[model samples]
Target: MHVLSRTLIDLYDAAEDVAPNEYPAVVMAVMHRLISFDGALLGCGLDAMEHARIFHRSPLLPSDYAKVYRSDPLACRLRLGLRVPVTCECRRFYVARECAEVKRFYQRHRIARVLLFGDPPAGRLPRRWVALYRGVDAGFTRNERARMEEVWPHVSRGLTANRRRHLERHVARRAGAASALMNRSGMLEAQDTDFRALLAADRLDVADGVMPERVRQCWRAGSTYVGEHLQISLQECGEFIVCTAVPLGCAVKLTPAERIVANLFASGLNHRQISERLGVSQNTARSHIAHAYAKLDVHDKAALANTLALDPSRVKTGRTE
Candidate 1:
């Protein structure tokens, strides 16, 4: 028991350091220490059975395993709903002809027994499961099942911690910006206080943890949305999207043309070059630059560059002209 406790602690600590993709392998490794198994699979998805998605598998299963597993009686039972840990002796649980394909798959892989455990959906967390497989015909003992039950919660918690740490790293990338993690369906999976506050400031309904339709559209289109009070930048991180919202402030005051002129001028283009590049007269280019200068409160080109530098989203550098 002492060793198990220590192992779980180490597992939790390790969750903070490993990348999201590597977390499942770490969990499986920790589980192997507590209970012996030949192969393992870790997955997460919504409460709905059709939504279940596999994230990782150790000692990779055959390519057809993905297609055949859904037909397995045990897997079908799990999909119906897995409220607790359960062990299945394949020969007893599988139907003779109904699950022939899945049975054949198991036979080919030398799998004869299985143990499954699940962490049901909670709040923004998805339904997660771990499956252990054995090649020998011997069924998993009750003691092994009990050990898995004891270890299941920590494994689930470790997954949660891994995702939180990943989102926190994205938040840290931009100082003073509100950060959030959203699923593919555009529901807010997790967010910090700053994120909630920012949403409230925008007058969007965040009570249901749903992103605004406009923001969702922008996310789907792989674009950024500049709102009345904030600018949202979406970055795809694994299965989730990292949303960073920063106050628009004065950056929003400039018109679209003014912003272009400002960026070109800041990129070291003279008024003539800016006009030629933009297909506008030199006077029109100067007029746009003058308007940008006044709106941004910058009197000179150097001051304009410095001001735009503070908000990189406002500047597009790397122009040779």
Candidate 2:
């Protein structure tokens, strides 16, 4: 009992500090103290197992494990939903022909047994699943299964807390901007109220909590997408992506060179200084600034600075003349 209590405490403490990508490995490590396992898989889904996506798999499993699991008969059962914790000896459980591929996978990896635990959906949280695997010939003891059941809730809570902390940190960093956190597969994990509002306001379909295809493309490319309604920027956060969006601003009309020159001018640099810094002629610098002023409709430095400050794509810097 003391060991279980200490392990739970340590899991929560580690969750508070580890990145979202690192949390799974931490959970697996902590679980090893309670149940002897060679590998583990952690995943979550909304409503049904068919939609379940694997977020983490133990290093012991091959890189292709996730791709193979998706089509396995066991995965099909998971699609139905996991109502309680269950243990299975792979060789005995996966005897059917349909489970042949998964069996081959397990045999190749030497995963002899697995214990599955599920955290059903509650309120805003999605359903979560964890599977611990063992390579030894012996099955898990009843006490070990009980220990897993007791610790499963804490594991689920730690995952939720870790995701919340990561999203909150990104939201804080991008203050006043609508933002969301999504898995690499483009599923929305956590989003700010403003982020949803921005999507709705732009009429971007977020059907079933999946980001729009355009946003997913930008996320995959690690680039920014500037549209007529909103400007979306992507930032990589370990195994997840942080997307920040803002309503379109006029500054987007400025050419790259003009934007750079405008920023230099707004920062109090004279045309000669801007020209020298950018290796352009003073006349060229003046020309770019004039074009920027016209495009942004800003007559002077103060207005230009204010306009640039409001530019969602502006790269804020401490550069000075």
Candidate 3:
């Protein structure tokens, strides 16, 4: 495989080992590797809300989309479409209608820079948006633009996959938590629709608990602080697990080899069949099945089947502080 491809895989694998909140940093690293921009930023959840919420923190912005888009000169230049794609939604009505509509809208908000791009894959946007600062050269070199464009599809694909995976995990976690909480009585209320809508975006974390002084201090010191929405509290304590919903035919948390084995298993393949698909010995395939069961916390295929039957939202396993 290509070096960047291998490196990207390694980064993803490593991401699995860290705290859930750390995932953004890992994602940013991947973005840096994929794009050659001078700077980049990411934000989730209320790309509009002003409060410091768990998912809304300006992973790169100063504050809400309006603030960041209005303050950066490069962003303004991009809005003017000096080098960026006019077809991109980021340009707003400026490029959309060629009318003063977008410009007027910006003026209404008193948002000056007007450089912004938001195509939240987890939200209403159909595709991830792109924004760029056409350097002083006025336009990107043909090769540079081409290279950037070449990777855009791959990056978009990766982001889409990641967002879907993230949302699946979020659903699984909420379902599991809600079921558990419900079974234990009314210790926790059913999340309201407003909260649910926010949570559904996969960017918001709304569990209540006490916060450590250090964490609070960190948020305060940052130029952008959206972590308050995370609702981290000091009273809660326990292991938390990140969970994902895997489709009926999909294998969750499996290596490529294991995925092949899982597909074989789900296909009603015996050890011999699985071995053939994996190009391994039947014994090896059997061993892999055993390992898969262990990872899945099941004993036999019957139990594995049962576990798989349960929706991820109904299951809870991973725990993190």
Candidate 4:
């Protein structure tokens, strides 16, 4: 337990430097540091037969994981099916010479023991697994297995943190956006600073970790909701709930003159038409339209129309264009 604690700290330290593409490598490295295994394989898959993304892996991994897995004894005992706490010993899956192909693969790599752990899919998150191998001279012991079990929770938490970082970066690629992971009850699990600031400035409230009624309804209705100053989109990532927020209401604080011009444009009035209606010259009407666009943070008529689609009263009435 004492050493595992240090190992746990080291685990998180390694997690901090892991990029999305290299998550499995970091995880394997942490396991190596803690367990001192020879080599490892980590990956994502729909099932044992469907290998998807290999996170971290040993060159020793057989060319055919599904074939080798099916032939292994422990896998046979489990009917090659995944159950909770997916960890198994090598001897259970294979004891040498049982299956000729697997035996040859194991012999070539000097492998005598294998410790496999599988994680099933959650929501949009896919299934993942890790396997550690040890050579013939030193197979794993009971104490070592227990140590791995003890450290398993930290392992999951660290990996989740890495995956979240990956997801956050993906969300950040969109302009003027921020995201968070919330539970179904509207409890805030984790969020970025951008999202936090948006929630702070809006009328939306997070009381006792639950989202306000209106926002929750919007989040549920169509996986998106547009309010006066904000718009939110939601998706389920595995068991993790992702919410993205973009602030567009800042444009609503346009001055009275600009607001009048923007609303006119929103109403399908051209510069000439607006000019005639307001008793202003065509050039003056055009200038007002330009200033209104700048204030509303819209680049074109389309964007202006979308902004106007939100309730007009949502924004504050007066500010200089």
lDDT by residue (tens digit), candidate 2, 1-321: 598889898899987798888788788888888888766767665333333333334354634566577766666565665566678888887785666778888888778888887765442444567777778878989998888878888888888788878988865555556888877667677777778778776678765567888888887777897765678888887778888887766556777788788888898999998877888899998999899888777798899999998776797533334
Give one digit per residue, the lDDT tens place, for model 1 in 196-301.
7887777866665667888989988989977766789999998788988887754586877788888888879999998778778999989989998877778998
Give the Cα-based TM-score of candidate 2 against the true structure.
Answer: 0.66
Tens-digit lDDT track of model 3 for 103-170: 45344433322223443333332223344332222333455455454444444445444434443344
The C-alpha TM-scores of every prediction are: 0.60, 0.66, 0.32, 0.46
Candidate 2, run of 10 with poorest lDDT: 46-55
Query: 2 or 3: which has the higher TM-score?
Result: 2
Q: lDDT at 213 for candidate 1? A: 86
lDDT by residue (1-321, candidate 4, tens digit) is 576677788778766776644655666666776676776665444233433233334433534655576665544433343443344334444554367766666666666677665643332233345667776556666666666666655776777676567566556456667787664556554566577668666677653345567877876776576665677788766544678887755344565666776777777889888777777788887887788777666899888877767743544322233
Give me the candidate number with maximum TM-score.
2
lDDT of each: 0.74, 0.75, 0.40, 0.62
> Which segments of model 1 are wrong by more than 4 Å?
46-63, 122-124, 173-177, 181-222, 225-232, 236-241, 245-321
| Clashes, model 2 | 2
The candidate 1 region of ten consecutive residues with least summed lDDT is 46-55
* Number of the candidate with higher lDDT, 2 or 4: 2
What's the residue-level lDDT of 256 in candidate 1? 71
RMSD, each candidate, Å? 9.1, 8.6, 19.6, 11.8
Off by over 4 Å in 4: 46-62, 73-98, 120-125, 173-321
189 Cα displacement, candidate 2 (Å): 3.5
